[model samples]
Target: MDALKEGWFSEINDLWPGIAVSLEVTKVLHREKSQFQDILVIDTKAHGKALVLDGIIQCTEHDEFSYQEMISFLPLCSHPNPKNVLIVGGGDGGVAREVVKHPDVEKVIQVEIDPAVMEVARTHLPFMAASLDDPKLTVNIGDGFEFMKKHRGEFDVIITDSSDPVGPAECLFQESYFALMKAALKPNGIICSQAGTAWANLDHVTKTLNHCRTVYPVTAYGIAAVPTYPTGQIGFVLGSLDPTTNFREPIKIFTEEELDKMKMKYYNDKIHRGAFTLPRFVEKALTSSHEIPQESRKEL
Candidate 1:
């Protein structure tokens, strides 16, 4: 993939075409060809430790909380009770760590396809992986799709912490995956998935949101800023079985004391509402006729 060159790691993929986000690497901590994909752990000069999968930067110690916290709390706080939550793909344990912090979340079940990612994270990224062994979490090594099929209408919330739509994670963005999640959720259940950056992949985001709208009574898209990600932004596709679901408003607003106790770094009641406020171009693209002209697909 030519990712590491001249002491720098650049994320170059056909998914985002010409643009690449590079980080200055101080040392290569670990690298391996796992059964599923290539995994690399590096200690960067500034961003601290970073987990890379298939030439893509999954998370860095510097800005991972923004993505992990927003993705987990956005759906968790929106639900009246997110007691039994299911995480589809978060091998680094960041999402699980954030989900268990919610007072309403009693139990969490995480399904990770690659065991090597978990092993690497546990060894190299202790800060994020520390909660993997929490009593409230059950770690299962298997495919999320097959797991959800057997346990139908079981969870109150399902958060998918998948990578970009490529390689092993390609199916996670498909319409069939949304259908299965809908079947796996209980009445009034909410589901959220990584929907990529609207600045670079608006068409991809729109397509996923459209797929979600087919099975969900209420659907909305939200964004978070992660500097390492393409275009310095990432978005989520959220949907709920309840018709009254409002993605813009949090059903459970945490007090300042609660936020301090939970160690929330990026999520709050106000941030939850602001995440849904899309830029003018993105708003038009998602709400307009489900067609993005090829000429308009340029990166903003």
Candidate 2:
């Protein structure tokens, strides 16, 4: 790919044009073109092992916990009893790792579109992939959208840990996808999906939240600091079937000792409440009556 040059791997994409994030590559562990996308695993100089998909940085070993933990717990903790959880995408297994750690979560079913991404993560990024072996998690290799269509009103919580809305993951960001997730959830179920960076893709983020609003009565957006991601930040779109659901306050509060036991690095009760608090600009953009251009809207 054109992203690698002079021992540095740069992430340059049309989604965030004119800007890129580069990491120094110490060694190339594995690189190949999978049926779904280009999968690359490399040993970085400082950030540790990283997984790259279709020339975009999926996660680096350094700060992946921030995104993984927030995405997993923000919704899991919001629900009173999230016993059964369904994970859509997240081929790297990071989301699975965190999802299985929840005390209330008993069973996890992960549906990933690309098995090649999971294989590369298992071979090169075991820190995140090792959790895929958890007995509580049943891994399925298939299309998440089709999988959700077959199962209805089953899962208590469904987390969509997808990449940017492009390539194989494009369908996961649509309003239809949110509707499907709504159909696949049990009563009082909550769903969270990866929303793009507001700093770089505010309009796209607003569009995603708007799509969720059409499906679920309660919808909110939250963010976490992921240095490797675009703009050093990433956001998540959360929706709950219950109107009383508060995305800002988690129902299950973890004690410090419990957090330590779970090895949580970035997520806690305080951080959970703060994640939904957006900057003034983002709040205005999401709440204001400003109409998005026709071209900016995603075709349903």
Distance from true location, Cα of 64 in model 2, Å: 0.7
| Tens digits of lDDT, candidate 2, 230-270 | 89999999999887898888899989999999999999999
Q: lDDT score of model 2?
A: 0.90
- Model 1 agreement with the true structure over 125-229: per-residue lDDT tens digits: 999999999999999999999999999999999999998998999999999999999999999999999999988888898899888877786788999999999
Best by lDDT: 1
**Poorest 10 consecutive residues by lDDT, candidate 2:** 291-300
Q: What TM-score, over all chains together, does every model reach?
A: 0.95, 0.95
Per-candidate Cα lDDT values, in order, are 0.91, 0.90
Model 2: how far residue 32 lies from native, Å: 0.7
lDDT of 1: 0.91
